[model samples]
Target: LQQLRSLGQPPRPVTSTACVPRRSKEVPLCPMEQPGETQDAAALPGPTRWPLLGSLLEILWKGGLKKQHDTLAEYHRKYGKIFRMKLGSFDSVHLGSPCLLEALYRTESAHPQRLEIKPWKAYRDYR
Candidate 1:
């Protein structure tokens, strides 16, 4: 009966660690970073992007759908093996190396589910 009655009672007041004062003078950086080295992801170069629309306008300006392969090749030459680009609301990273592709293929699930099947679904419904 006492244990059941305790369940209805409010939680006890707790002291937060944030409220405590630190003895150290220097603040620690992110755990992901080493002492001297910077993050590799931040160093990668890519095209200038606009807010909300991202790099969509820049990609279209290069030649739209007709020259997508050419544009990617141009970017590959400019940005090296790896580059980041955004289209409308979508953001993606492009890898131009065969070794990276092979590694990704080896690591990927055997039965990966396809997310971009709207066109196939539409065709099936129409048929």
Candidate 2:
């Protein structure tokens, strides 16, 4: 380590008076960008919000599950296959194609371990 230190006093800084060119005369932003483009939260839809309670009112009124049957039925009738539904900040993917069943039913030897448990079991245990 001493032998290496003998070879160098860190290189001297070089100073130049050249002014850096501005890209567009706009405010500079960090190169590390956010995941998605920044947008105003007010412009984004939260829920069919009312005056005071915002989305919580609808959720409380429905006892949690949104009345989503109408939208799903409508999409199936119109799209005839697959469609996406936005439900209280969560997404529900609906697949209408017959191939969807085929894909689920077909099994391979190397298929991953399935954690198949009935949904009612959880509710029963909770109760």
Candidate 3:
């Protein structure tokens, strides 16, 4: 309850990393970085991104974050072995191939902190 209450910041909502205002009529404090030469640097194919919100609005349209697992599977079918997604300002690549997974595991740390595994909840509880 305390953790929930402390997260409230009216002027700009507080995310884990940065403060971002909700998608609204108000002008944003910081503009979304226009992908210039950096855009071409990434070679992965993915979802179309709109300015400011990136692919967030599309996620909402597709059925919000709860259905994201299914959505990603659908994307894998559509985009093939690997694809990219931009959520808010964060860009991530999804790997669907076994070879890609094996390659990643080879290069990972001893106790790799990978994304959203079931063990993460247990680890967090242990911590």
Please name the candidate that would achieve the greatest lDDT relative to the true structure.
3
Work out the TM-score per prediction.
Answer: 0.53, 0.30, 0.53
CA deviation > 4 Å runs, candidate 3 = 1-41, 108-127
lDDT of each: 0.55, 0.37, 0.56
Task: List, residue by residue over 39-71, the lDDT tens digit for candidate 2.
Answer: 332333233544454444555555544554554
Find the 10 residues in a row with the least total lDDT in model 3: 32-41
lDDT of 1 by residue, 1-127 (tens): 0111122333222223242225422211222333223334435578876888877787789898788789989998998876778777776667786543432343335554434759779999999
Better of 1 and 3 by TM-score: 3
Candidate 1 residue pairs in backbone clash: none
| Candidate with better lDDT, 2 vs 3 | 3
lDDT of 2 at 95: 49
Tell me the spans in candidate 1 whose CA falls farther than 4 Å from its real position. 1-43, 107-127
Candidate closest to the true structure, highest TM-score:
3
Model 1 C-alpha lDDT versus the unseen true structure: 0.55
What TM-score would you give candidate 1 relative to the actual structure? 0.53
lDDT, candidate 3, at 66: 86
